[model samples]
Target: MFVSRLLAMCFLCVLAAGGTVAWKQRNVTIDDKHGDEVTGIAPKYLPSHAWSSGPRDGLNAKPNASLAYNGTWHDSTHWVNNDQIIVNFGFTGVSVYVYCIIANTPPGPFFDAFANYHILLDGVFVGEYRHDVEMIPDYFYNVPVYVNTTMQNEFHNLSLVANSTERAVLLLFDYATYTVVEEDPVVASTSTDTAAPTSCSLLPTTDQPTGNSQTQIEVIVQVGAALGILAFFVLVGAVIFHLNKKSRTPVLPGTTLRHISRVPRHLATFYRKIVRSLTSHPGESGGVVGDKSSVAQVRSQNKD
Candidate 1:
């Protein structure tokens, strides 16, 4: 029973180790697609009256109305400096890798003042995107070009601050797109059959191990430890079985067991001495007190 309990404890330890490793090894990512046009996440950030003067420029302005527009929350604007356009992603931040897309106004940059804009994420200044209209020709104003910026960390919300470098240089703002990036460990089973599942779930899997270095090392270590524990348990169980069998076997009589079989050791010795004395002298048993002397004499006369 002791050996069985020890083996069971060892097995539990192995299981706990496996669970710990699995918990530490887990890693996953999730990305969300929330565009202003689709889920209306933008309305919560930008308000209605805080847009630059257009034919009818307001927050949530549609395309084709005016290429010369702006995006984000807050109504604060200024002609001299400090024109902030903020887009809030709320408290629950999304994954990393932010991609923003903006289109220039249809009227072209050569006609209007260019925009020198600074990008910020969660209040930290990132980089700048310059739409210097004077350098660009009128033909290319309608065409959309790519301007990209990357951050070392992900954030909940982002902001684009625009201040006029020149007189009346109002930057036309377009809708921004939000997306998340994620990656997780991909496990492949050795059974490359069409029916096999691609995931490493609890379903039946092949005996062949994974090809990844980390996974292979973990598997080897776990198997080795488990086998070692099992081997130890088997050895202990065999020894215990032999010891128990030897302990239960009966002893032969006439040895030390005979003297000490039932009674106490001292009492057994006294009883043995008494039996030896009584059986050795047979005459003492009949006339020890001489009370039958008369009977003995009568028997002798009859005989004569």
Candidate 2:
């Protein structure tokens, strides 16, 4: 029984370690990331005009694409139909919301500038820009003159498509801006744990009194478990010690002289007195103490 109980305790310890490891793995998740535009990409980007680079055409985000050489910007410098304004936005595969800015020279027709172009996300047509034409060429306001992709989830390469087939009708790259949308961790991350609350996990580690109380309770349980293990080990040790002591004693079985010889030395005198009294006559002795069978047996065994 002692050996079995010891083995069971060792098994429980192994199970405990395994359970801890599993718990750590279950609740762990990579954090969600959120931020703005080309900052997330490497090398930022440089404008790669599909047709030809007009002098002073710098591709950059926001007010950065603020100016071009002549009269701020003129007459289709980066023609949407003929040119692919390659904005090498750094990273890919994550969700992001992109806003494309289209600008025109002062006095240019506010609505006419948006008449003939569409935008592509990695080569697929998401929508057209002329849908929301801004009506003021007032120099600084780069309005969403096209598809306002407020929540387009993912994109790597942004391309602009135009309506003109043979002749390059005008439209320019006003610079595009994108912001990373914080996305929840992948579904696979949440599958193993169903977000259940367990009492054992309520151990507090901070300033809240409730948490502290829970932590105290957990500590007590751990201490109690430790003490129980110690007690079990002590009990098993005592049993083994008793069995060993019994094996070492030279006591023989049933009615043997060795059994009588093995009696404690302190009891030997008393035993001798009893034997002498039994053998003596009842008149000479103080009394006859044993039953008849016992007396007969003792006399027979005396070999006298």
Pick the TM-score winner.
Answer: 1
Off by over 4 Å in 2: 1-90, 93-115, 131-137, 145-155, 165-168, 180-208, 211-304
Q: Could you tell me the TM-score of candidate 2?
A: 0.31
**Candidate 1: residue pairs that collide:** 69-173
TM-score of each: 0.34, 0.31
Q: Which ten residues in a row have the lowest lDDT in candidate 2?
A: 23-32
- Clash numbers, per candidate: 1, 4
- What RMSD, rounded to one decimal, does every model reach? 17.5, 17.8
lDDT by residue (35-108, candidate 2, tens digit) is 23334332222243232222244422112333532213212323434443333332333333333335433223
Give the alpha-carbon lDDT of every model: 0.43, 0.43
